[model samples]
Target chain A: MGRIYLGVDGGGTGCRAAFWDTEGRRLGTGLAGPANLTTDFDAGIANVRAAIAAAARDAGLSDDDARGAVCHAGLAGVQSPQTAARAAAALPCTRARVDEDRGIVIAGALGPQGDGTVLAIGTGSFAGRRQDGAVRSVGGWGLRLGDCASGAWLGRAALSATLEAADGMRDPSPLTDALLARMGGTPQGLVAFAATAQPADLGALAPEVMRAAADGDATARGIVAEGAAWMERALAALGHAADDPLCLTGGLGPLYRAALDRDGRRFVPPLGTPLDGALILARAYAEG
Target chain B: MGRIYLGVDGGGTGCRAAFWDTEGRRLGTGLAGPANLTTDFDAGIANVRAAIAAAARDAGLSDDDARGAVCHAGLAGVQSPQTAARAAAALPCTRARVDEDRGIVIAGALGPQGDGTVLAIGTGSFAGRRQDGAVRSVGGWGLRLGDCASGAWLGRAALSATLEAADGMRDPSPLTDALLARMGGTPQGLVAFAATAQPADLGALAPEVMRAAADGDATARGIVAEGAAWMERALAALGHAADDPLCLTGGLGPLYRAALDRDGRRFVPPLGTPLDGALILARAYAEG
Candidate 1:
């Protein structure tokens, strides 16, 4: 019997879903608004369902076909039973499973039978490993508490660099000029901009921090260097997991790779999309 | 007429006001609600007024006498013209002055003409210096962006150590027990606590970080050592002012001092209360 499958990577910024077949071929992918339970529990569930529906449409499949599909969601904010319940209530299917985003990211990086480790970075960050086929993870403490070397960290570093420039402690930075332009040329404007700014918004400037460092902004360089140090700290916390085949993902992963001076077996996932991980997860469930 | 003066310290957790005379004799003092500008501007102003009014009443001053008194406030959110104006409008005095809490703190530490430097370390932290009668500052970029080595930083470090302990990346910490007890035994509970927790609240447990260090929690030792380093960094930055007689105040000041390993040239102010600085400023204006 032909079967459909759905995979999702749910994070603070949004819920992303992908549709797949039993052979691990991705048919379609979709993006919806944020699905992190900490911010909006009910809305997060709605977003997951909507993202699945949209991906099915993109795959030219009907709701009935989608309903028959098995689904797996790699989600942030699953640290609690309430979050899991909220997600389970939203996605109706033949079978639905939820795990931490770390699991999905690792599955994508290492594959079903692949024995390795992965660090997922975007709005948040964490390292996951499959050692002797038992999965364990570290880091990814969420934005306010941890998630070091993640996009949020990069964004916060950019803001710190800009503020240092305004405070006259750091020499002028290229990122400062770019940030000021985006913030309308005043420190007060910058403050207002940062009042509602998120990790992704700041992560968007990770490239700018990199560019400024290249152009000799000592402070910007320091910020990125500090960021690199934080990443190292996280990696250190991973212990033996660092020796595993380490894969990097998210907005900051590629940008920070050159800056990371470490002795580890490293590889970049080829697909350039987390949706591929979702599809693989989906296909595995379909095959089972 | 023996003139009365009002002194206010508007901080993150609350606002405090006291009434005193030119002779440095405290007449009365009162405490009120939170006064942080980033979160609660209106409440801050109201709290300041409420504290002052209560102080006046306790000092046995009539409404007319209070209205004629000189008032000086060191406020948390006086950074904005709008907030400063709101504060000035609220004080029931002809000569009402509002300044950054840091400025007032320095003034309080040194007396009005007692020129020097100060490290204010309450819920937040910053270093301020006055040289040749000009004010210069280091750190205190505010809680979210900067204020490294402050109470908030200490608290965040404690939390990080707790998580590291949970993951077994570091040796178990006394801070782990303190934090686990404080956090109600879960990571999710800890996040919820952190959402509303302040720096001083965390700094209160700085001893745990120090104790954990002594007990060989590498993570905790690292936190205290890093705090010392950050303090050194702030001192180095403030070195640009090229002044003498640095003072340290705020909640973490006394706690972090011996760990700092700095010289006696950096004086701890004799006065216990920051209100003395407000009194000093009021007296200076009175003399002028």
Candidate 2:
């Protein structure tokens, strides 16, 4: 019967939910299966509901109380406002808000009221800033158009460079040679793969490029440098100040963090995880 | 009725058929609507049939005679051997061979027995050569993967440069400014366009980029120079010798020819049309 808050963060990997009472003390948490809404809406929504239920059970709240709880969810594949609104309508909680998983990273990494920036670059890329309780973002345009500095973008660039090398436009290198070998030793092989490759499929190659760059492969180094340059440009375009507290997140986040730091970018470590940000949002919304 | 050759050249724009007798005397020629077999297979086939019928009528040959004549078709969108086979099977001709449109460009430009190289950079790109009755090719990978020096590739690179400029990674220039303005004055607008753009849609922008380059726009110049460089590399990769009969063909072909010629490339003019190449192939196949 008392005020309760539910915070849910869902991505391709899995879903996490945190429950807390009105006093801002955590009651319990629950984990669930992968919940990428865009790829599998039914499964994602189901997993989301299941995670909330488990969190409620762990918190000793009745099913009805849990359903009545104020909730906030940050999920992957929430591309449009319609998706967000639909997700909110689908949730069990009576008072619920749904948002792209990215938004929560800002609060999670920079604290609920922090004024700084966050760069989330994995299979996709975007830069965000929360200032004066307002949030603005740039560059979540997906791999086909943009998503510069993202894992998918990096992978695509590497593959492109490999093909260019094969065509003698670029100097062949160890990385290009290795990539060519892996892609069936011909440009056709890469072409066949690219014909049906999704963003994640492309992003799958980012680690290799990064690893090769670390080992001083000229081609890989150039790729990484270009990605790093894009990141810097993104930050600047986001109006990031030299002294702003920057937090990098996502799978390729750490690699870029190092690159940016080495390039004189002074970044601050995240205060918490996205789940924490969700919980913070849940509490803030309920309290308001 | 003794021996007649039918050469069909089918593309996105239109289809042409040339009919010839044993001594290589031209019988007649016919034109029809767009016959790009890949995009509109039924229409393409219908148009091809219609064109051949018209040519037969012009040559004073019966439909049966035309169908029995040895035939060769060079068509756009013949990406695979299977498509070629399928096209060959579907044509009305009794003895027919099907090949990608690019192949015929070599014969058309270099003559039936001419040993030479050809670089065709239109909405898509490919480099090809015919020597000693054998044809070899490279770099027809398409816009998504590797259409080096193609119009689509140029447009994509220009758009990418525009986005990079918007992000502060690349220096903003007149070309980028004009592109941004034309594309709704925002990176998001470009992203929106790219989200659903086909190769042709992207290639549609190539003319503007080329024009800008011709007018001394720095970003446009860089894009064109890059495309020109790819042309050189592709020619070299295809084993083009200093004295090889190089022919530049396609919508963007002349633009690149100018660039390549300025860069010391000596290109030969087409000795015939794709229809001629097809007719030549028909004769070769039937005689043997």
Candidate 3:
């Protein structure tokens, strides 16, 4: 039987799995609910398994074929060695490797021999650099302590600025009024919404901020600029040189391109999706 | 039956109930668990009731006497009029007035007629000013939106700065090291801790930051300065004048005094505790 490779990108919001043949041809893909290991380890494992099974089914593969597949999962919340080991052990595949989601993001953006950095700004944000066959990352500290320049941060900043405007701390803007209206048309409503909002919930508002920024709203423009500044700081921390190739990935990444100071730097396109990077790892494991 | 007044200071950490006669003589006091209305309405109501029951028991009063007592409750998370009305209705008192916890704090610190500002910096932070029988407030937007100089904000800032130091984005300090050590001695550990940390849990770390600041830790000092700056912004927004009397209250309030720029303002001592304020309100209600 030919070797089957499975790649999984498990994040706080959802999980996606891709299946491929030994020849590097894509077979099928599947998606499931959130799979952040730290938030819910059991649910994460279950979702990963479910995604793999669904991918196999979509590819017309038997149950045995799915079980025999070699898997590489780039998962959120795999921060520590213990968590990585635990996640690896929990996978249904006989041969599976678990790593931080940022690694797959870097690989998918830059490929095997590519040098430079990738700044991923999605529901969460992280910057990764590949040098000397090793990957180093900065700022994927989740929504609380870090994830600066992330969609979550952008939305949070907008909400806070809107409240400030409401309280006359800052100039009122159409953007703030629109945001408040969406949050039940009152500052108290926004406060209520913020109390129970998760990272993804906040990130969902990022597109609105971007829309307002594009329309020249001062508060929105300020938020986007601040986020871009944080991204620049992250890129610098990742040791990106002036001429280094950089790729911005994730949902809110492209929105930041114009805002970022790209002087003397090359903003390259991503080689593939994180799923592709996961597949590459899976294939390597299957070959061995 | 004599007119009995009950005052309840309900907070995120715990609820305190003080019983007094109409003439303002203290009868008894009781303590119970957290009673933040928004977080858990039923639990808050139950705790308030339990605290009152205990207070009456300590004062050698019957259940009927406690049930007939006029009460005033100052609770956390009574942000909107609807929540306040709901809370008032749920209270086990003949005549109850429910208000935002900050009002009681202002009353306790400045007295009913004392004009000026009060900065309450506990697990949550809020600034309020009393003028002409009305109270105006700013920056009690909770842990997510505002609460700038709050203990929760302080702990969160320390954790974030510690992570930046760990990532080489900033210089490491003893304060960060000690904080990291408490959270399993690693950045990963800190991330894990942050995922599930509630406001009160984060607020618990504020004293450590204060201690480190006093010991001359640069990171700790930065966090303190930032908090003080936020307080200043909040105070300014509250329209505090140079001559206005300002009183700082709450667990982390006094720690901020040395960091704050008084700018020729009179810093006064709190007239009484929140319980005292609640009792005063209860007396007013009873008299009317």
- Best-matching candidate per DockQ: 3
Question: What's model 3's TM-score?
Answer: 0.91
TM-score of 1: 0.87
Q: Estimate every model's Cα lDDT from 0 to 1.
A: 0.72, 0.83, 0.85
Native A-B contact fraction in model 3: 0.62
Worst 10 residues of 1 chain A by lDDT: A265-274
Clashing pairs in 2: B109-B270
Q: Comparing to the true complex, what docking class would candidate 1 get?
A: acceptable
lDDT tens digits, residue span A51-104, model 3 = 887888789888778878889999987877788889888877788889878888
lDDT of 2 by residue, A1-288 (tens): 578888999988789998887786889888899887777888999999889888887888887888877899999878678888988999988999999887788788888786898988889888888878888777776787678889998888899888878766678998899989999987767777887898899999999988998898999888888888878777777788888778888788878765787554568878888898998888787768
For residues B1-288, write the lDDT of model 2, one tens digit per residue: 578899999988789998898888999988999887667787888898889888988999887888888998998777678888888898888899988887677777777685888887788888887777688777776777678778888888899888877756578988899889988887767876887788889999999888888888899888888888877777777677787778877788878765677555577776877788887778778877
- Better-scoring candidate (DockQ), 1 or 3: 3
Candidate 1, lDDT over the whole model: 0.72
Stretches of model 1 off by over 4 angstroms after superposition: A25-31, A56-64, A81-86, A131-133, A168-172, A176-192, A233-244, A261-266, A286-288, B22-24, B177-186, B196-204, B210-217, B240-243, B263-266
lDDT string, candidate 1, A92-131, tens digits: 6768877667777777777766666666766677777677
Error of 2 at A279 (Å): 2.6
